[model samples]
Target: MMRRVRAKKFLGQHFLEDLGIARRITESLSIPPSHVVEVGPGMGVLTQFLVQREDLDLYLVEIDSESVEYLHQHYPQLSNRIIEGDFLKFDFNKIFPDKFSIIGNFPYNISSQIFFKVFDNRNHVDKVVGMVQREVGRRIASGPGSKEYGILSVLLQSYYTIEYLMTVDEHVFSPPPKVKSGVIRLVRNEVDKLPCDERLFVKVVKAAFQHRRKTMRNSLKYVEFDHGAIMHLPVFDLRPEQMSVEAFQELTKLIEEHPLCE
Candidate 1:
């Protein structure tokens, strides 16, 4: 029997309780020997299923000190894999640094930020599978022209083949969330076809979505000072939301060549 841990609203704790769901989440990873990292292993509910796979190099990261202590006492074999810190602030390069896969029933509050973190380190991650709010999952998997489609969709799509794996009903979670949840799998693009500085790419994507209703010309203002070269872009009159991921890439290239910064 699993020991109960008090749900902390401040931490956004909604522990997954369904055993079948836990197994399904584990199976989704297609775990190979020496390949697994789970974030926010609350109560070791999912951890119980994950560590059983001898092939998996299961590791857990928990931020709640009490929960970490609880995990330590309950699962001594997993102690080496346990790291106590905010997964967002934890250095990916320092953790597995090289390429590895990650799984979790992530805290919904910082789920989007987690996506950004993974995007920033796409090169280091082989694949990422996690359950986040269903609405967020839709946004990440959203296509161009959908209301849900914006910077995140475009930015992530540029580097990954995102799949909307499955949706879990609210009942699956203990002290269930008001919203439905979903599982998403992101596999990093092996081809490095995007042609702009990673930093500038982020800047361009954020600027476009910052003023989603604005045209390319107006959006460029968020990132550019002088409009000399920016105005010359072929799609300057197009709204940022109307532009495709490729267009954003082209615009970033233009920004680089004419450097409004320099």
Candidate 2:
């Protein structure tokens, strides 16, 4: 057996030990396979199965040096595919000139940031299959009106068709996390462009969700939009959590088109 790498607290490394779960996570990738990037592949549990898929050209990006070294010793077939760097800092376009999918057991500390990274590369990222804190997974897959829904729910749902896959118990990890883990997959939709100004759309969504408890009428004040006229609209009465992606899109347009331009 290869020497085990210690789970680093700072890196949020909870190495997944359940092989069945790993296989399930690996197989969750869609058919007609293409380029796949596995982030935070601690100890290569998932990599072991991902390597067998002849259809996929897989690359591993891990921030942990010890885990990376362990992967190097065990998965010699990986060769140059192992990247010793932060996935967030990586300019994936440099390594992946074309489209790709992402899959991994994402670190709890950086999972939200990771999705933001995914959102940045939505044009190239066709799908994402990640295991994260159960709460976060639910939040990503959640729809409007649910308490679990928030900023990420609204932003990511605007682009990807998110699905909550399954849950893994805390005990499944080598160093079990405090909470259960959930798997979620995001499949890109057919929306080439949205009806509203995309930049304003983000601003409106972020602003509204900043105070999720407040109505959009109150919360969106942070964005400095002239709410004088648009506040009369029925949507303003609803809280940020109550608004769907389409509702936010319309809200963005209303804000942009309002005559009170500063």
Candidate 3:
């Protein structure tokens, strides 16, 4: 028998009790999984569907001891698959020797952090299907010139082709979040390596977006590059919000080839 576990506010726990949504979320994983890891499987609402798939070597990582115990008690079939630890700090390389997909009704507070971890391990993580705050989903999948477009927009879109799958109603969760949720799918693109320095590309994108109101020429002035040469480029005339991922890549190359000092 399953036992009731209170959602911890500190952890931003909002259990998805709606089985229909759970089924949809699970079915969204189209990959023939060698391995899969579900983050924060609170109360096993989504786990119930994931464990049914014989193809996937499914694993659950939950932080709450009470919820972990409940999962073990209720879903004995999971057996040793349930890991009690922080998903952000867990060593995924040790778990899945090769590639794997990540899925979850992610904790809203740490959703961005979770994505940053995913970005760091993009080579091995081929696909990601997860729920996040609608605003975040829009921001990630937003394109150039959109007000929603910002840091996550350029960074994640640089390597992955993102799709905003659907909007989930707030009432579906046990303790419904104030904002509606959105499901998004991220598929890795064919670009193995970037045209410019990866570190410098990130720095440029972050610096460009720091002051959205300013033009790239003004916003990127402090980025340790040749202002005189960069100022001549037509791209500088555009605001950070107006620049595409490809445009940023080009800017990175410009900075690399034409350093004012050194």
lDDT, residue 149, candidate 2: 92
Please, what is the TM-score per model? 0.92, 0.97, 0.97
Q: List candidate 3 segments past 4 Å from native.
A: none
* lDDT (10s digit) by residue, model 3, range 1-262: 6659999989989989889989999898888746889999989888888888987888999989999999999889887899998999989988788889999989898999999888889888888999999999999999998999998889899889999999999899889999999999998898888999999998998898889999988888898877876587788889988998998998899899888776
Ranking by lDDT: 2, 3, 1
For candidate 2, lDDT tens digit of each residue in 1-262? 6779999999998999999999999989975768999999999999999999988999999998889899999999887999999999989879888789999999999999999999988899999999999999999999887999988998899899999999999998979999999999999999888898988888888888888899878887767666777788888889988888888898888888884665
Compared with the true structure, model 2 gives a TM-score of 0.97
lDDT of 1 by residue, 1-262 (tens): 3457778888888999898888888787774565577999988877888887887788888999888988999999988889999999978667674688889999998899989888877787778889999999999998878888887899899989899989999987888999999999988887675887768888888887888888878876757545774587568888776777887888778777876555
Question: Each model's C-alpha lDDT?
Answer: 0.83, 0.90, 0.89
**How many backbone clashes are present in model 3?**
0
